[model samples]
Target: MQTHLARAAASVDTRAAIPEPFADDALVTQPQLKRLTGDVSDMTIWRWRRAGIIPEPTSIRGRNYWRAGDVRELLARLAGGAQ
Candidate 1:
């Protein structure tokens, strides 16, 4: 029972980290990316990008931005198994 409860809490926490009503075509900036990804460090994002776990960001004016659609896909793939 405790294990189940812990698992449920963990799932909820992960979901809470991601903002709701994710617009498919929206371009998420660095800060928003962090929020969507459970406030992961910049290094983690770089690593994921390098590892091909995530698609490369669209650089604009020397800033990084990721498509919401891509992020949604990633979240679906990662959390699908747990849920």
Candidate 2:
């Protein structure tokens, strides 16, 4: 019984050590976008979108979301240009 418990605990530990999969194309909401963008304000994000600096967002059920890949690509392009 002790060996069985140890094996079960080991299996649980192995599963815990595995990181969750992240989807690059997943849709992220405004709060998540703000977090990704270094905690920038909602208005700043809105302005960037309005100015055509960022990719357009998709709205579903009256909530807006942007693709994670799109945001990452935009940041990468901007960083490359800045350097």
Candidate 3:
């Protein structure tokens, strides 16, 4: 029936209008770290890590990850110190 079809279409449209779940905080990874640092090479980060320049990353499942907020804070601090 036309009414039933219209109701079905409206239901689908309503569902589509719902927003997808989005995370407020995004986790940072090594690749993101590289992008933030503007240094493409892992060796550069590795050297920074070894020299106690950058904060140590937290390891999980034998992989390392840095907090995005921490990286941002470090960048802000570095920028402030430079000026």
Number of the top-ranking candidate, with lDDT as the measure: 1
> Model 3: how far is 51 from its true place, Å?
1.0
- Candidate 2: which stretches are off by over 4 Å? 1-21, 81-83
Model 3: per-residue Cα lDDT over 1-83, one tens digit each? 22322332333322222123423244567876665554346876676687665778988897778765566554554444421
lDDT (tens digit, per residue) of candidate 2 on 15-76: 22212364666887888766554455677778778767677899999898987677666555
Per-residue lDDT over 1-83 for candidate 1, one digit per residue giving the tens place of the 0 to 100 score = 22432332344344554466867778888877665655566876787787777799999999999888887776665555421
Instruction: State each model's CA lDDT, in order.
Output: 0.66, 0.58, 0.53
Ranking by lDDT: 1, 2, 3
Mind sharing the TM-score for model 3?
0.57
Worst 10-residue lDDT window for candidate 3 reads 11-20
Provide TM-scores for the models.
0.69, 0.63, 0.57
Clashing pairs in 3: none
- lDDT (0-100) at residue 74 of candidate 3? 48
* Pick by TM-score: 2 or 3, better one: 2
- Give the Å error, residue 33, model 2: 0.8
